[model samples]
Each structure stands twice: as structure tokens, then as C-alpha cells.
Target: MNFFIKLQDKISEFKLQINYMKKFPKIVFIGSTNFSLFSLKELYMKQYNIVGVITSPDNPIHKNEKYFSPVKKYALENNIPFLQPGNLLDDTFLKNLKAWNADIQIVVSFKILPKKVWDLPKMGSFNLHASLLPQYRGAAPINWVIINGENKTGLTTFFIEEKIDSGKILFQKEIEIGKEETAGELEYKLKKMSGSMIIKTLEKIMKKQIKPIDQKNINSLKYAPKISTKNCRIQWDDPSIESIYNKIRGLSPHPAAWTLLFFHKKKFVRFKIFVVKKILKKHSIPIGLIFNISSSEMRISVKEGFISIIEGQIEGKKRMNIKNLINGIKIRKNLFVR
Candidate 1:
């Protein structure tokens, strides 16, 4: 009897949500990654009137093979109409997008939109950025924040404009960054926290309760450009040990921080370091040289400290813990890293 009563209560709550969402304007969603999927799922669960979805074309995985994006897969499962346009400016694509007759659009983790598309909706479009606006205003904001050893970061919603991430702010929420948080872990936390914030933004916009703040008023802006291969390389001689620690965790699990392992100053192989501990101790060994190697651990000397490898991967081997990596490979003391 208790289970049945709880079930009925849940059903009633769901109905209430549906009734509340009836007043929401017709919404069109644009996104391509897992971060975008979280927002889309929240809106759908609240029974919002999602008119259509816009995502990138299927990505090629191998020759003659392609895979659907996370957003596209969700849209397919829920029977939501979606458009995969190769070019956002294509005539047919624009025509179909316009036909959706969206009252407003919400963009997250997607490409830059041309003005024509952003201006099509009667109510205007807004984008959700992963960082506090006027700072970290570019791709890979999450990664950059952790990489730079920032202790505080936040999310922002702003109107879409010609300049990327420079529009008027709709809403902002500050969040704390854990000292040991990796980029992937922080992203997960923020994505989960975004659902309620998105719902509130839509509610405020519909009620005309928002006073958008121009980003120009904010100062001390820092940019987060797209991370490149060059940026992921680890330099052992970097003066700051904290910087090295931050770099390893910032790029953890994806495009990780890497270095070259030179064995006896002859043959060299690449290594991707996934996890490490920074030990700040005075060391006489040369920087980037492997000072100690045990069956269960590996340590390399750096300026003013040592980097203890907890988890890592060789060029052609799968990721492994230090013990397993040691057992699999012959890591001699003379084998230095660069």
C-alpha cells in the first residue's frame, strides 16, 4: 500500500510539471556534446515544448563508418525531430530550421552561429557557457580553468552575439573548484548542476524578470583558447611544481599531459602521464632524469621536487598503474624523461 501511494504521488508530481510547462514558449535546442545533452534532458523531463533540435553531422569513426552524437542519440530515442546540417548556412537547412517556428533557442557546447540563424527566433537565442563570462571566453574553458590552477570557477548564460562569449549576461552561478579535481570530473559536476539553472533561466526570460548585464562592464578578462598538441607537452624544468601538477590533472583522461622518455640518452618513446603526486624536496639529480625506479613506483626529478607517477601510459600501450607499468616495461634509472 505504501509503494502504491508513493507511485501515485510521483504520477501527480509529473502531471503538475506537465501543466506548468504548458505555458513555456516553443524552444529549439542546439548542441552536440554530452554537456549539451544534460540541459536537453532537463528541459524534456519538465515537459517543455521542444520544437526541434540542431546538431552537427555524424562524425566519421573509421572508413565508411560514422557515429551519432550523444544529443542525436537521445533525440532519436525520444522521437524528437533533429537536423544534422553539414553547413549551418545552407539554404535548405535554414529553411527547415526557420520552419520550426521556435519562440526561443538555447545553445550549449555547439559551434558559433551566424547572425541569421540566431535572429530567426522571435524571442532571441541565448547560450550557456561553462565559465563566468568575460573570462575564459573560448573553447575548452573547463580544461583551461583547471590547467591554470584556479580555485574558483562558474557558469554563465548570455545572449548570443557576433563576438563569441561576449554577449549580455542573463544569469550566472559561481561554483568552487576542488583542489584535486580533474577537468573531466569538474565538467561532470557542472553539467549535473546546470539542469536546475537552465530551468530557472527559461522561467525568468518568459516572465521578463531578467535585466541583462552587458559584459563590457566586467574587467580583468582572461581568454581560454582552444587547447592544442603543443600545450599538452610537459616541460620538466618548469620552475613551479604546482603548475606541473595542475597541468597533469587538467588534461587527465583526454589529450593528457605527455613527455618523451629518453633511455640512456639514445632511444626515446612518448609517455602520457594520467596521474601523479608532486613532492617538493631538494634534489641533486638532473631535472627530467629518472632518479628512482622500483617494481611498484617510478619517480622523476624536476626543479625543487620530484614527480611520482601514479598512473601513466606508454606510446603504444594501454593505460596502467605505476606497478603494472613497471612490471610490463624495463624502466632503468638511466632512462630520463623530457
Candidate 2:
């Protein structure tokens, strides 16, 4: 959710993509303002006439006293016209957007716009999605792709339509997802790719030569439902090694995947698993048992093998290597993680 995604194409190809946008006709960049900071800067470098920016209204921060505006910050820094209406469906928003007079709109991470808003631009209103639609379409496509163990995914620029993420694709470039890639990694990859793809799609439109590609039967579509605390909890009893391994890495580095454990005395506690390793199937041991412990290996019993917790953080403690926690905390033998 915090990172950006770029493509894995060659250096020459990247250059060409940037050039395509640099020579685009009038365009408007719309979407979640947080991820647009860097790309907005690049648009200015290319001297593209940014008719306006459409984003959600500013929100309050941690405390009620402080206010934060991610999109507004970027707009003010670059002196671009910005509209942050409270509701995208507001009549005022619709009326004002139409006044911008842009030939096309470049949507990145914004909410689903109404049909009227999507039709504002004369040429077309194009959106950049994190996944190669309609494979992964929903609120959290980047997270679900990595969670499902996808090898290759990329950004897609498509014409806006009434149905969500069901528009005709104008341009797409696939990027390889590493074996150990996390959701954070894929997000960054898609973010960067979308920026360049936006420019390329806009250039084709400038020349009035874009060809819409259908997405109805390209592949089976998967809905990427928003991840919550309930779905992120780790299940130690799972049999497959790959799924268990993914459970740890998919949520790694931010809002990390969690598991229930008992640390001190008989209290059940929650902890986040930061690192884990593969374990070959051996004779079954009691579930959640601390089967083996050594200066070298901190192994715990599972259905088929030992799931050794290499690194983690207790409910409120800072994350540290398991070796350090083992040395510092007094882990009782009868304690268990269920």
C-alpha cells in the first residue's frame, strides 16, 4: 500500500515510454494523490499542459488537531489546478471538471469516477491499474497477486468504462514478480510502470491512433478483496510449505502477518512473524510444541515439520532476531502457540 511499482523492461524501452508521454497532447492526472508526487514532477518536465488534478478531500491525521493532505501537497508544490471535492458524485465536482477543457485524463490511483466524470475529456479518460486486468481487479490487486504467488504482472492503461476496471486496454507491459517478492515490492513496481504507461497511452491518443483491446476472455479474473487483520492471521497448522512461507512474506515489512502465541506464563499473545524457513516433513510431533531448541536452531512443531521462527516481535515489543529474543526473554517449556 505504501510502495510504488515500475516495469522490468530494458533501459531503451523505458526511455521510449517516457518520450511517448513527453510528446502527449493536453492531459489531466487523476487518482490517489499520495503516489502521484514523483510522476507529477516528471509531467511538468515534459511540458505537458496539466489541465487539472482530481483527488479526494484532505483527511485528518493521528490526532484530530492535525490535518494532512497528500494530494493537496503535490498540487501546491507544482502550482497545478487541483479539485478535492468531498464526493466524486457531487454535481459541483462534475460541473467544475467539465470546465477544465482537457483533451484526455490520466487516472492512476483515484477512486472509481462516475460515467460523467469518465467522459469529461474529449479524447478519452484512461486509467492505470496495478494488475494486467481483468486478472486482478478490486481494491487491493497488488496485495492479492503476491499473496496468490504470481510470477509475472504489470500495469495496464485502459479507457474508462461504467464497470469497474473493465475498460478496453490501450497499453500494457508485464513485469516479473520475484519468488520472494512481497506485496510492498509489487506495489512499487506497478506504481512506476503506471507512470510511464500513462505517458505512452496519452501519446497514442495525441496521434489519434490508439487501439482498444478487449479484456473479457484474456484470462480468469480474481477479485482482490481488501486485507484486514482477520485474514492476515497466520495458521500454523497449514500442511503446505509454500502457503506457510507465503503467509509470512506476503505481509512482510509492513502490517506484517501475525500469529497467536503464549510468551510469559499462561497468557495467549499475538505476534508478527517476520522470517521463516522451509522444513522437510518428518515424524509428527505435538502441534505447537517447542520440540527442539539450540543456539543454532529454534524449532517449533507443526503438522509435518518444524516451523522455526527466525525473527519476530511480541505484541508491543520491537522486532528483533529470534536469537536475541531467545537470549533475553524467558520462554517456558509448557508455553504454546495455537
Indicate which candidate wins on lDDT. Answer: 1
What's the lDDT of the predicted structure labeled candidate 1? 0.90
> What is candidate 1's CA lDDT for residue 231?
97
- Find the 10 residues in a row with the least total lDDT in model 2: 1-10
TM-scores for the candidates = 0.92, 0.83
C-alpha local distance difference test of each model: 0.90, 0.75
- Tens digit per residue, CA lDDT, model 1, 71-137: 9999999999999999989999999999989999999999899998998988899999999888899
Candidate 1: residue 210 Cα off by (Å): 1.2
Could you tell me which residue pairs clash in candidate 1? none
Question: Per-residue CA lDDT of candidate 2, range 13-101, in tens?
Answer: 87877766454456677865555655666676667778788777766666666454565677788788989888878888888887877
Which portions of model 2 show Cα errors greater than 4 Å? 1-24, 64-69, 290-300, 324-328
Model 2 C-alpha RMSD vs. true structure (Å) is 8.5
Q: Give all candidate RMSDs, comma-separated.
A: 4.1, 8.5
